[model samples]
Target: MDRSPPVIVFPPESGGGRRVTIRGEAVGTAHGLFDVLELLHSAGLPAVDTAVDDPELIEWRGGGPYDWNDGEADER
Candidate 1:
């Protein structure tokens, strides 16, 4: 059976915030997520947190599906 991939929508960082759109199926794995984060960080837009409805399906924010030891960032 085939399943439709989840959609990842990144909220804006500040003031009227811009929306960043990314495909879930294209980045539905740990590595893919990490790569996305790294890309964002490199672009000077590191995510403060991520949110998703389905935990088992995908981690929408804050390094989902991966162990993050850095607790310095606020996820509120």
Candidate 2:
């Protein structure tokens, strides 16, 4: 049986804040890598420092880590 990853980082919202979910439960919103790390830490997750970049540990949707932009560019 294939099991999903424990942590899920949703697509960036309108404000560049992504939704984080752990074990199928909504945890919080994160605007950057540090924020995601903090959320993982608060969730009592182990090895959060390294887990942030672990694809198997965290499922990044829409974009990978470091992608906090809301997909908008400034008009010249």
Candidate 3:
């Protein structure tokens, strides 16, 4: 199974929030990384940290936590 932050879909009207649809299943609604884990845990799945901290899954670690939004348009 692909463990690279399972591609999720945020459909409209999902209980008034962005329902996290992972692997075609609507686990729950989340808006951040921490919430992602909560959703997974609720589904009986391991948290993202478990995957990121696992040495064997280094390839999917995303190569360190670097600047995610450094370059961006100055919207004033």
lDDT of 1 by residue, 3-72 (tens): 5333443332333222333443232222334444554454455333363334433334433323223312
Sort order, TM-score high to low: 2, 3, 1
Instruction: List per-candidate RMSD values in Å.
Output: 12.0, 4.1, 8.2
Report how far off residue 22 is in candidate 2 (Å): 0.5
For model 3, residues 1-76, the per-residue Cα lDDT tens digits are 7455453524323233345655566677543446656766776666676643443422212222221122222132
Deviation from native of the Cα of residue 46 in model 1, angstroms: 2.3
lDDT of each: 0.36, 0.80, 0.44
TM-score of 3: 0.40
Two-way TM-score contest, 1 vs 2, winner? 2
Task: List candidate 2 segments past 4 Å from native.
Answer: 72-76
lDDT of 2 by residue, 20-62 (tens): 9999999899888788888888878864567878877899888
lDDT, ranked from best to worst: 2, 3, 1
Worst 10 residues of 3 by lDDT: 60-69
